[model samples]
Target: MIQKAQEFMNENHFADVSRVQCLLRKMMSKEYHGLIDQIKEYQDPHAIFNIHGGNNLIAPTASQAEQKLVEKPADEIKKDKE
Candidate 1:
């Protein structure tokens, strides 16, 4: 999971910081030492959106005209198509 997260950060140019948790345990882990860093972390509020994942992709909503088109009588729609 950490390696996956590392890749995500690398691709997105991000640095990880716990919302508030300290990394004392991680820092103590020799296995993670090479992957760890001590630095000031700041949040860019606008950067909260996803860049790669379509997770943030919003489905386009039907406009009032579109909704009306759907609600129109089939006969009326057929007449317009003619």
Candidate 2:
């Protein structure tokens, strides 16, 4: 399970903190079981959000639309995409 989480993190950039939490919930259970806290503490917030054009391929800061998207339910976002 840890391996799966690592892979998912590798593929997906942590732009929205809530999105990361949502993933942890889906991947594990109701709670991330300390995973979210660990990431926040260990990882650099700027790097996670890819604020600078570093070699690491992380996501950029969340735009206004993205902020709103995060506020919406996952189901609603999926529906909008469809």
TM-score of each: 0.22, 0.28
Worst ten in a row by lDDT for model 1 = 38-47
Worst 10 residues of 2 by lDDT: 41-50
Q: Give the poorly placed runs of model 2, Cα more than 4 Å off.
A: 1-14, 30-32, 41-82
User: What is the model-wide C-alpha lDDT for candidate 2?
Assistant: 0.45
What CA root-mean-square deviation does each model show from the true structure? 20.5, 12.0
User: Model 2: per-residue lDDT, tens digit, 6-75?
Assistant: 4454446545546665677676743445544344312323323322234333434533333321355545
- Local error of candidate 2 at 38, Å? 2.5
lDDT of each: 0.37, 0.45
Return the top candidate by TM-score.
2
Tens-place lDDT per residue, model 1, 15-49, is: 55542124533434554443333222322223232
Q: Residue 71 error for model 2, in Å? A: 30
Clashes of 2: 0
Tell how far residue 1 is off in model 2, in angstroms: 6.4
